[model samples]
Target: MDATSRHSKILDLLNSQERVEVEDLAARFGVSLQTIRTDLRDLSARGVLSRVHGGAVRVSSAANRAYADRRKQNATAKQTMAALLAEFIPDNCSLAINIGTSTEQAARSLENHRGLTVLSNNINIINLMMGGEAKELILVGGTVRQSDGAIIGEDAV
Candidate 1:
């Protein structure tokens, strides 16, 4: 397969197994060891995985996936949860939305709701609710996380 498709499959394998050996990948894909090494290096560069002695492992637990990547993963489930959350919010009320992909989905689901006020620390949520039916959108300011537009730090608390 082509490089992009191969990379996707490698990511899938990593997701399921949490790690992959270079030899196994080369044998499975009918490619050379160098090819698999290169694939691992590329994926590592993209922050998708970490290259080890004989293979690669998923990135560390301390680091979150890229915002776009996190948003795409379990997207359907997030949407469903957002829809359910929207059903519970009544009109002319207020809400405190947090940062993260799920909260973004929840904000999107609230676009049609009227007479509600939204309190959020996520810049994306504020942008989404702008000019909508919500009566007011209050952005709790602090340090904005460059990775996910999350306003955090002690000031936000």
Candidate 2:
């Protein structure tokens, strides 16, 4: 397969699997570990995935936020940050907000927007966005984390 196709496939796998090993991809794709690493590097550079010690993690704008505990620990700060960030987003735009407490706060901050499409993985965020004026809201499916209020696993794509 071409590099793009291969990268897409890799992303699909990473989205589905919590983690993937370099050797496994090399063996399954009949490529050398070096080639797999190169592909992973290119994909990571594009913000498609994050290179971890064992594998990669899918990258979403919401992925930039802190965990629920950290977010809740400073709810005021998160709310303030969300309010500030919300100012930069133009109306009637598509945005994929990841599943995290801070991102949830950000989503809540957008409640006044008239039209915005939000793709998310957090059920909590989705619940909040449902009450917003956004034109569209999409929840990426996968394993759900009740504690963190985010989704992770095979169905996230």
Candidate 3:
């Protein structure tokens, strides 16, 4: 495809998926990795995307990226951090968690925990810890945002 078409396609992919790896984009477009990197750099300069090590992510604003995209972002890092956080959390304790992908990862890490009460405003977290060893799970009363499964009502706060 031409450069114009490639740029448009790249933006479309970023909008729907929130991230694109240089290798994948190169393979898809049948171009060199350097071409994709140059395109990403140009897009980044235009304030539409942000370049990372081997990929580019959609420019996140105060509103945040799509929920699915957020979950995929730095997932491995989140899992590692969550494991460390879990180590600090002793058993037989009441713990509260907030909404977001990192918090969800933390919840997964704490699944094997015993004698623990988990209170959260994230619907996903409530579901994730259900089959775990947590003694109790509490979900705050709020309006559930369907897009991200976040509870965001007055009662939640």
Evaluate all candidate structures by whole-model CA lDDT and list the values in order: 0.90, 0.80, 0.89
Q: Could you arrange the candidates by lDDT from highest to lowest?
A: 1, 3, 2
lDDT score of residue 99 within candidate 1: 87
Worst 10 residues of 1 by lDDT: 58-67
Q: In candidate 2, what are the lDDT values of residues 1-157, reduced to their tens digit?
A: 6778878889889768766678888888888888888888898888878887756777755444456446656789889999998999889999999866778889888989878988888888888878646468788878887667778888886
Which stretches in model 3 have alpha-carbon errors above 4 Å?
A: 1-59
For TM-score, candidate 2 versus 3, the one ahead is: 3
RMSD, every candidate, angstroms: 8.6, 10.5, 8.6
Output the worst ten-in-a-row residue range by lDDT, candidate 3.
58-67
Superposition error at 28 for model 1 (Å): 27
Local error of candidate 2 at residue 56 (angstroms): 28
TM-score of each prediction: 0.62, 0.54, 0.62
lDDT of 1 by residue, 93-128 (tens): 989999888899999998899988889999999998
In candidate 2, which residue ranges exceed 4 Å CA deviation? 1-71
